[model samples]
Target: MKKFKIGYRTIKTAVGACIALLIAEYFDLHYFSSAAILTILCIQPTKKKSLNAIYTRIVASLIGMLYAFLALELVGYNPIVLGIMLLVFIPTLVSFKFTDGFISSVVIIMHIYNEANFTVSLLLNELALMAIGFGTALAVNMYMGDLQKDLDQYLKNIEELYRSIFSEIVKYLRNGDTSWDGKEIIEAANLLNKAKSIAFKDVENHLTRKENQFYLYFDMREKQLEIIERVLPKITTLPVMVQQAELVADFMEELANNVHSGNTAKKFRSKLEEVKEEFATMPLPENHEKFLAMASLYQFIEEMDKYLVIKQTFRGIRR
Candidate 1:
């Protein structure tokens, strides 16, 4: 059997619901348990999402009250009237793009329908319920678990994967080693996606923050990884190791050693330019096989240059 553990969201939802119930009961509001339901619905993983849920629920509940009052007063309080009201009310909410609030609104509509009365006092009571429930949810959801430590670990793991990948490429270029299973490439790709997801969640948790530097950093690495994947076959399939391979291998080793969050792409790009210049002075390939190998090596170098250029264009994450 799979093990289950309660997460922070679960804890927050429980605490918020209990608080909503206590406040509602203290006020002696009729149908006070509805406040707990509202709290449960409003609690979300991110503060921004929770706030949006609160807004949608409040607007839709108010609209539902209006619909209930009109249908009950004009058509009389009957089951058919309730059904017809829902038919029109659901479509109206959908048209207004308030679908998220449908369930909570239905709860409010039922309360008014059960009372069979729509008075100013009833409206005030429902408003109070909304305030207590959504307010409690908002208060509880304000404490988002800090993700910075996890993001930093992800960054470190991704950089280590890059180092391993570069080291493997260096081995292949230097002595035609094919022992490596290229697991680091797959691992890095998966880790980058996971990191980006977490970083995006972190962004959502901060209502006023429009951008996340860690997210941008992972995006940059993902682009570089794409280039690396595209060039891997060319590097591994080189027909023979040429003198230029040694130069490329040296550059790869240096890059592997310096795999970090810092902006060192410019320095590497300068070194790459020197390597390209030296390539121009090297003797022509002796045969077709050597020519093919040299061609592949040149393509690999160009791709590496692109990889560095991607980092160069990125506004790196601050430490």
Candidate 2:
């Protein structure tokens, strides 16, 4: 049954359609199915999108009915008239920026064709169907709820990957442990990409545009991951400067534990800076290999600085 489970949106649409049918039947509308059809179409995942769908549907229905009425009154109902009506109506709706309603508008055209006469009673029936369909969708979506929990879960997943990646880096620096396959780095990047998409959808769900912190958080992680990749290879080539490497490993360990903490980022940056200064004071390398090692360590410092700066900047951003 788990494999056959349906989504909440599916359930909501079905329930809304049934409610719409009951309302139309109670009102004695001849084409009660029209209300149900509209209900199914109008149920959207987000309240904002649902509202927009309702608005466009109603406008398109009005355009459809108006065009149908004019065409029927002047030229009479026939296949030729219906063809001409669609040609003109589709373009007119496009010009008026009501294209979102065009598909739903076809149902209105069908109703006009079936009735074959444009009368006040028939017009009332169309309006009643619109009200019932749109109203049911509205009521169903009012409790569709927010995606804050889902966003939080994504954040947690991404942070776990971050922790794994940093710990791997720490292990390599401390003992030159080459057991890590770098799979976590790729996994983290992929997860961050997924999280960014969901976070943007969350942003769109709100009527008022707001800064999506989750999106920014993942964006920062992605930037840090890129720096990590570059740092990994450079650190591997450095001669074992046991004391310096231990300092780096300790800082990385602290960073992995507090991946989500903004305050810890500043402390890590300060410690890394001290390590950079200490590296500079060490006696000049006696050969090319030592010089290369010194250069690589400096490069690693610069990358680590950039990584910490990304998080710090993200935390300070207002939007």
Candidate 3:
């Protein structure tokens, strides 16, 4: 069974709803309970999302009030008119991309319908309820818990996975060891996906910041992981191990040991150039199998070069 725990969002929702209801009741607003409902709907995980929710709710509520006035005052304060109003209002809101506010707007429509009149006092009461609820939710949601520590942890985890993957590659390159299960590839892919998701949420939480360094870092790693996956078959399926394999294995071991957030790709790129020059000076393969093995190793080196180039282009992580 999954463990049950109340998270920060749940606490915020509960507190915001309570504050909305108390404020509405203190002012003796009609249908004060609706304030709590609005609060519940408006409290979102990120500040940007909460702001968008409030904007949609407020706009849709105003539009719903206008529809309620026209349908009930001109036609009749009856169930049939209410149904017809919804039929038109729902489609209109959807077309305008205000679907998020559908429930909140319906509450406003119901209040006007129950009153059976479109009086100024009723309009002001409904507005007051919206103000109290949306305001409380905004105030409560403003204090989002810091996500920097979580993002940092994700970065560390990803680097560790990358290290493990490179170490495994080094082992296979040095010897024809097919014992490894290659679980690190799958694990790295999954971690990158999750890390990118959380990093994007962090970006959303910061309204002024248009870009997040962690998001960029994870995205770069994801691209590099794709290249790594593509080259895995080439490495493992080499027809025969050549002398150059040991050299490549040495480079892989170095990379694996030095997996970190810092930009050291340039240093490695120079070393890679030396390895390529060494390969060019080596004697041609005497057999077909040796030729194939050398070709695969050459391709692997090229792929590794591409990998380092990707990192070289990226600006180092901010301190």
lDDT of 2 by residue, 135-166 (tens): 99888976665677887888788788889888
Could you tally the backbone clashes for each prediction?
A: 0, 0, 0
Please give the lDDT score at residue 249 for candidate 2: 77
lDDT of each residue in 251-308, candidate 3, tens digit only: 9999999888889999999999988999998889989999999999999989999999
True lDDT of residue 83, candidate 3: 98
Q: What TM-score does each of the candidates earn?
A: 0.98, 0.91, 0.97
Better of 1 and 2 by TM-score: 1
RMSD of 3: 1.1
Query: How many backbone clashes are present in model 1?
Result: 0
Winner by TM-score between candidate 3 and candidate 1: 1
Q: Give lDDT tens digits, candidate 1, residues 194-246.
A: 99999999999999998899999999999999999998998898877888899
Record all residue pairs in model 3 with backbone atoms less than 3 Å apart, i.e. clashing.
Answer: none
Q: Which residue ranges in model 3 land beyond 4 Å of their true spot?
A: none
